[model samples]
Target: MRADIHIDSDLLQQCRKGSSKAFRELVEQLKRPAYYHALSLTGHSDDAMDVSQEAFARAWQNMSSYNPSQPFYPWYYTILRRVALNHLRSRSRRREDIDNGQIDTMLTEAGGPGEDCQSVQYSNLVQQALMHLSIEDREILCLKDMHDHSYRELADIVGVPIGTVMSRLYAARQRFRQLMKESGYEHE
Candidate 1:
């Protein structure tokens, strides 16, 4: 096992014993990546934050089920992904149309730098294109690129084989590139 995995196991052991410091360390380590994964899956910051929080709560409640011999991220991310997917499915009434207006509102509320006109335009374009993608594709891309998971790790999180992970990642990247090219954002 990797050194980090060993350290994670130690943390998990402490957490299982109800050590608050260990729980804080575990949450601090996993939170940002989990949030990013949720955001990429849900495409809404508010939903992602809520999902991440819920996932952590669930994880803490189910800490006994966590296998210390395995990696922690896949187990943690599985919870976040499920929560986000559930949230998406519950709103299936509004599935067909890509809500650009809501996405714009979300991006604005995220409160990043939009003062530079070019940056704002670029951010808007990226947001629109991301919204155009199916949630599944976005989730795959986010797990692979944004979360920097290995194919095996992604497969474990998404409950697929490594071959499927590779194929889907390839296809999703190609599609994202195609969308960027179609939007005239590709450089020569």
Candidate 2:
């Protein structure tokens, strides 16, 4: 998620200087978003956890490459995305796990309390539709829509130009809308 939390420059400097304590603090701050973002890409809790942890390890190993002035998540996201994508690639197939139970839990968390049956069903449909999308399409959609990343953040996180981010988000939205319609979910 695009949390407004900023990594303290001091903390980052210490991390760069090989302080495991500082890096642990960084992990405490970012671990939730890291897992959730990885989950969005990997579609399984176990895989997401593994991928995010691996990304964090990689981030620590490559600490010198990080620009302390920039937001940590975006930089960390690059590692997380790479790790997640590699995991996805190694799996050799997109599993149908999203439809099973995780999507329901995610929807419940996103929806908060008092969601009706209709809302749950709609969320299920949306998740199902998302599963049908290409990984690129799904990643862009989740990064923008689910995680609240801005266009510039999207470009930075996805390693694309702002124009490419806009175009991809637009195209991904169109395809998602079509998928929703096919799943019998109509929206204005």
Candidate 3:
């Protein structure tokens, strides 16, 4: 097996033995990937953080059920993705009932200028484009590009066939390129 997979197996074994330190190490190793995956799905930092944390908590609780031979990140990410989707659903419901006062409050809270305005602007634009994508499209992009997972790994993680992963990835890239072109970005 690959070095990363070997390390992951070891960490998972440690976690299954109820070692808090091992669990912490696992979290440290997985957190950034999990957070990025969540962000790619939710298009919001707060939601990503919440989803990532919830995923880890659930993983900790269910550590005993983890199969050491399996890849850990995919298992963890599946949980994070589910949490993010649930959060999006809840947000959609709340949005229907949002009042003018709440809207104004949110705007005010978000109005502060940041130091790296250009980076923030770019990030926001990318996030907006991602938000326009279908969930499957967003997930394909996140798993293949952001997380550097292989198509086979993605298929396993998403419970889909490899052909489906390839098709979704192709469609997602085409849509993302279209979105970028529409937004005045030069698409290759």
Candidate 4:
């Protein structure tokens, strides 16, 4: 997820001076994207909530290191990504409870799974197909498609050149299309 708004310089200065209100404001602007971004990586609501909060705590602790001249999210994203990756690493050791029911709810909402069983089945297949993607692929698709980020924002958040972002997006979509085909989801 990307925020088009730049961080207020005054807010940064105040935060640097230990102003709690300024810090809270900054968190308010970011916390939703941060949580959704973490959710994209972690694939579990609980893990996303925990890791996102932890990343914010770390961001506050390391506030002095931030360059006020730069866009805040790219730097903040580094911290969030590190924390999320570490969580993924540790959690890989354990059996993750795949919450398919929760996923069904999400798909139903997005696909508007109505009276039609076919659409529900399609949504489920799409959800399962997403699980087969690499975390990077899934993250890019969600950040760009679901979160409505521009290519420039995508480049910044993903830390890649615009061309690479374009190429990766193409490849990810192509792979997803293949998955859908293989899963028997015909185009409407």
Q: lDDT scores for all predictions?
A: 0.73, 0.83, 0.71, 0.79
Score candidate 4 by TM-score against the native: 0.86
Candidate 3 accuracy as TM-score: 0.75
lDDT of 3 by residue, 52-155 (tens): 99989998998888877777766776777788888888788332232222112111334556536665555555655666778779878867875578878888
Model 4: residues with Cα > 4 Å off, grouped in runs: 1-5, 93-97, 102-116
Candidate rank order under lDDT: 2, 4, 1, 3
Cα lDDT of candidate 1 equals 0.73
Greater-TM-score candidate between 1 and 2:
2
> Which candidate number would show the highest TM-score if scored against the true structure?
2
- Candidate 2 lDDT, 1-188, residue by residue in tens: 46554678899999999999999999998888888888888777888899999999999999999987787777998899889989988887735434345645554676767878898888878888877888789889888888798888888778889999999999999999999998888898
| Model 1 regions lying over 4 Å from their true place | 1-7, 93-119, 181-187
Off by over 4 Å in 2: 94-99, 110-114
In candidate 1, the residue pairs with backbone N, CA or C atoms under 3 Å apart (3 or more residues apart, or in different chains) clash, namely: none
Clashing pairs in 2: none
Worst 10 residues of 3 by lDDT: 98-107
Which regions of candidate 3 deviate over 4 angstroms? Answer: 1-6, 93-125, 185-188
Q: Positional deviation of 65 in candidate 4, in angstroms?
A: 0.9
